[model samples]
Each structure stands twice: as C-alpha cells, then as structure tokens.
Target: MNQRLNRTAVVKRAAELADEIGFEQLTFTRLGRALGIAPPGVYRHVSDLDDLRRAISHNSARNVAVVLSSACAGLSGHQALSALAQALRDWAAMHPAQYAALQIAPDPNDTEGQEAAHELISVFASTLRSYQLEGNDLIDAIRLIRSTLHGFITLELSEGFKLERPIDLTFERIIIALDAMLRGWAV
Candidate 1:
C-alpha cells in the first residue's frame, strides 16, 4: 500500500472496485475511499469521472483481448472458436463490471482505446481465418460473434435465463451452433 500511485495503478484499483461494486456505482469518491485518499486526490491520476471510466474501459478491453487471444492461441476452426467463446464467457462471469465496461463504445479520437478495440477484433478475425473469411465477410462474422457473445452474457449477468435446463449446456450449444454457422457462412 505504500507503493506510489500512478495512472495504471489507479485504473487497476478502479477496475477492481467496479467488479466489486458494479460499474454504475464506480466513482472517484468510491475509488478514492478505496485508495485511502480524498476524492480530489483521484484527479491526479484521472481528470474526472468520465476520464476514469474511459481508462477503465480501455483496460477492460485489453484484459478481454488478452484472454481471448491466449485462449485461441495455436488453435483453429471449431477448436479455436470454442476456446474463444469459453474465454469470453468465463471472463464476463468472473469480472461482471469490467465486462460491462467493454460494452461502452470507445472514443473514436482516443488512439489507445481504438488500438485496444482493434486488438479484440483482430483476435476474432485471426481465429475465423480458417473459414476463409475476409473483407466484409470477416467484418460481418466478427459482428455476429461479438453480438452473440454480448447478448448471451448480458442476459446471463442479469439472471434473465429462467429455464429448468442448465445454463452451461445452453451456452455450449450456442457455441456449437456458432461454429456450424461460421463453417457454412456465405456472403
């Protein structure tokens, strides 16, 4: 706790606070309290609440891209897709608030944010290359995968799945379906 607090450290702590207290509840005041400093002290690391949120968003995107890239490493086709899907779901389940942060569109003018976002898409595109997807096809496939994962995770996080069957089974089935669709994709 005696370590010097910098922007990276502050943002890392803020991400933890978000996971613990929910992203919507994450504020400079709360982060400052958690850091054992006055609320105004947070301004040294982040300009304001929006700045803090943007930092958290960028960090969240990086975290997710790393996870997905690691999962898909040395894998291809259905194996790669399955690993990526599982990684995405596991990351979201483990860090709901940080995962929620990824839902926010990054500032178009922010280079770091743009790079982090592109990193994620690059992972997906690399994995889907086995399907011979390129150009608009690759873009569409990325959107499909992202939308499907986001929709399912959002619902799961909100406890919207009211079913007698196990949720894990459903998630696995969805991945299987996605893999099949991608294999036969034409457009």
Candidate 2:
C-alpha cells in the first residue's frame, strides 16, 4: 500500500534533512526513504536535487532574516550594527548547518528564491542606514560588515582558528574592528 504525504510536511522534512545531512547529500531518494515513501514519491514536492537545494536555502535564509530583523528593531547606528551582527553570529552558531545552506546564492530568475535572498540582505542594508550611510559608501559598508561576520562565523564553525586566544576574544576583536571602521565610515 502507498502512503499519503502532505506537501508542506514533506518540504519541512526535506529542510530538516538538508540541515542534518548537508545540502550536497540531500537527494529525493534519501528524503523519500526517511519519510517511508518511494524515491519517485517525493517528486510531487521537489522536482530534483536543485529544487530541493533551493527550498532548503530559501527556508534557511528566511529564518535568518527573522532573527536579524528582531535583533535590529528600535536600534540605530553602532547599536543597530552591533545588535544585528551579534544576532547573525548567534543564529549561525546555533544552526551551523542551516547557516551554511543559507549561504548558497540563489538564481536571479527564481522569484521565490530571489525574494528569500533579498530579505536577508535587505535587513542588513536597512540597518546600515542607521549609520548615516548612503550611496556607494553605504553599499560598500554593508558588504564589508556582512562579509566580515559571515566569514568569521564560517571559519569558526570550521575550526579555522589557529591561535591559543579564546574564540570569544576573537569575536570581540571583530566587533571592535567593525566599530572602528564605522567610526571613520564617512571619511
């Protein structure tokens, strides 16, 4: 007998699988087996591995945006930046696998995927205005901060730190570096 499946439930399950097993290893076969369905059965929800990846990335990005938006609320300038940076770092630390999946760039043609990706960056860009940023400088600053936080978290999660210094200290140092950069931001 064939089992019935809910589309929403399947996508949620597939998303969980993506985080647990990593995006690259997520296949319809694996998801179907886990869900007690045939491999082809999953085709009703996900067309292929790429579609599955897009779904996973979209979910992860949306979750990150929720966290970031909450953190930056009612704050401005350095305070906003600090709140956002810490929030992003904390989210990434807690959900390393999900965070990694969220880093995948979405295809511009994929409307859903693009909107998800936009939410993530838009939150940062909006918080950036609290710094009195504008034009190319604003764009550049946002890129710098995002890259810094993302790179640090990615490296830390991968055990890339080689020094005897505490990881906490390294993160603090990063915040300080960003603060200094922002202080001279308009120059």
Candidate 3:
C-alpha cells in the first residue's frame, strides 16, 4: 500500500477494466497492476473483492440509467420507446460489461445498489407510461421490454445471432414489434 489512492479512483478504474477484460476477468491483481499499487492496497479502498464488485455494479447501473434516460428525453410513446431501445443497444455495444452489470440483482440489504437498479428500471417504466399503461400492467410491461431487450442484446454481444441479416435491421424490427405491442397493450 504505497502512494495515495481512493475508493472512487479504484472503482472508476475497475469499471473501465471491466469493460476491457469482461467483468468475470476483472481481478484485484489486475486492477492493482493498472493502478500501480499492490493487490493488498485495494483492500484499503474496498473491503474485498465482493465489496469492489458491489461498487462496480452500483457505478454501472447509475451510468447506464443516465445514458438511457438521456436517450428518451423529450420523447414519448413509440418514439420514446425506439429512442430508448436504440440507445440501450448502442450503450451495450460500447460497454458490454457495464450493460451486463445491470443484470446482477442487487442484494436485498444494499440500498445504494437497489436505488441504482430502480433508477435504470424507472427509465423504462417512465417511457412505457407514454402508452397509458400503469399499475400491474406497467410493471409487467417494464419486465417484458427489459427482458426482450436484454435477451437480444446479450445474444448479440455473445455473437449468438450468427445470421447474415444486418443486426441493425433486426433491432429496428424489434422496436417496431414493441411499438405495436405497446399500442395494443394500452387496452
């Protein structure tokens, strides 16, 4: 533990490294090497590997939420939904690990982690409201859209598509299908 380092810097670098090496490959030793500190020094900033993972999750959620929210700004209904869909895909393409981080369920007692997750979902929930959906229907809609987008993006990131069709075209069709679903979903 030499030189000065803080949890914030450590977390930031870890998140970057997560995007670089995949979240599973991220390790304190690698992070330490990048930070020019001993692996033990990371303990000074974060309690342990799990704690650092939590911090990364929180950071990733918050960042993704902001990106998605901005993408849907001043738009509603199908337009908002489409903006959100494309933005999410673009963000995931750029930061697959961070996007994957959003999939990690927050611990029940982790308020900060819970809040970050909620904010990301809220972005989708708000856009769905444009279709005049609410109550249980709204919750279901959010889950559906999240699941749809998550499944598609995950497969795409993993190169599971393996088709000759342009990926963008498939994504656009998905947005069109979602728009149609939401329009009828209002009833």
Candidate 4:
C-alpha cells in the first residue's frame, strides 16, 4: 500500500514537472527533488528511470484518450478525423511536456500501457471504419492520417514552419489533404 501510494504521488508530481520543465528534462532525481523526497525513495515506487517514463507515458496516453474521445463524439470520417486532429494539436500545444512523454512507444509487454495507447489510436481508427475500411487499407489510412498529423504537429511544435506563411494555412492544407485521402480510401 505504501509503495503504491508513493508511486501514485511520484507519477502525479512527475506529470507536473513535465508540464513545467518538459518531458525531455524529467528525471528521477529531478522528480525526487520536486516531491521533496530523496532519489532512492522514488525507487521504492518506481524501479528506475524507465519505469518513471512508462508511468508518464501511461498517464499522458490516458489524458490524450480523454481529449480525443471527447472531440470525436457526434462526428464521422473526415469530420471526426478533423476534430481529432485539432484536439491532438491543441492538447500537444497545451501540454508540450506531457505530449512529448506520450510520444514514446509503450512496451508490448505492458498491456495496460499498450491499452492506453490503443484507446487513443482506436479513436482514430474507428473514424476510418465508418467508411467501411478493412484490413491493410484501413491500417494504411490510419497510419497515413496518424503519421501526417504527428509529423505536422511535431514539426509545428519544434517551430519548423517558421517561414512567411501562417502555420494555420499549412494546417488547413493538411486537413484538405486528409479529406481528399479519405475520399479516395479503398473500400
């Protein structure tokens, strides 16, 4: 019970630290200091840094799932995809550190973490299913949409599109491309 509670507290603090400092800088020692606990104390809760990272990944996945699911409600196909895309970008913008934490791949053995990731992906995949997509075609569309969104958002967050054109225009263009892709999706 004590370890579980400590793990919970540490995960919560790590999340806040990620929000404040950034996921890239989040470390066990930093997390310990943030919680006013010794570094070793954290080990009683988390096995090591990787464990802490997993916790953060799991936490952010759940958070993103909530955001995506809420945006996907009452929408379908391209409409749903647009809502999901905007929500993802907004969430990443609002929670850069947590968002970065979520970018890490969850361990295949960690079913809970994988499930959390799946929840978010399913929100996107389910939208495609509305168009009666199946097998490789459906998977391909999901990959296309996800990769497109992820690449664009990741670049935007890194300020890659710092040219004269407004980023919003570029984002709008992406939406158009996604819509066109959906229109041409194999049945």
lDDT of 2 by residue, 1-187 (tens): 2355766677778877766777577788899888888899888877777777677788888988999999999987778888888898888777766787787888878898899989988898888775677888878888899889888888987889989989888788787788778768875
Structure candidate 4, residue pairs in collision = none
Model 1 lDDT on a 0 to 1 scale:
0.91
Candidate 2, 145: how far from true, in Å? 1.2
Top candidate (TM-score) = 1
Model 1 clash number: 0
lDDT head-to-head 3 vs 4, winner:
3
TM-score of 1: 0.97
The candidate that achieves the highest lDDT relative to the unseen native structure:
1
CA lDDT, candidate 3, residue 184? 91
Q: Candidate 3 lDDT, tens digit per residue, 50-97?
A: 888889889888998899899989999889999999889899999887
- Model 2 accuracy (lDDT, Cα): 0.81
| Candidate 3: residue 34 lDDT (0-100) | 84
lDDT tens digits by residue: candidate 1, 1-187: 5258999999999999999999999988899999998889888888988888888889999989999999999999999998998899999989999998888788889998899889888899998989999899899999999999999999999999998999999988998999999999996
| Model 2 worst lDDT run, 10 consecutive residues | 1-10
State the weakest 10-residue window (summed lDDT) of model 3: 1-10
List the RMSD of every prediction in angstroms.
1.1, 2.2, 1.6, 2.3
TM value for model 3:
0.95
Which runs in model 3 stand beyond 4 Å of their true positions? 1-4
Error of 1 at 91 (Å): 0.5
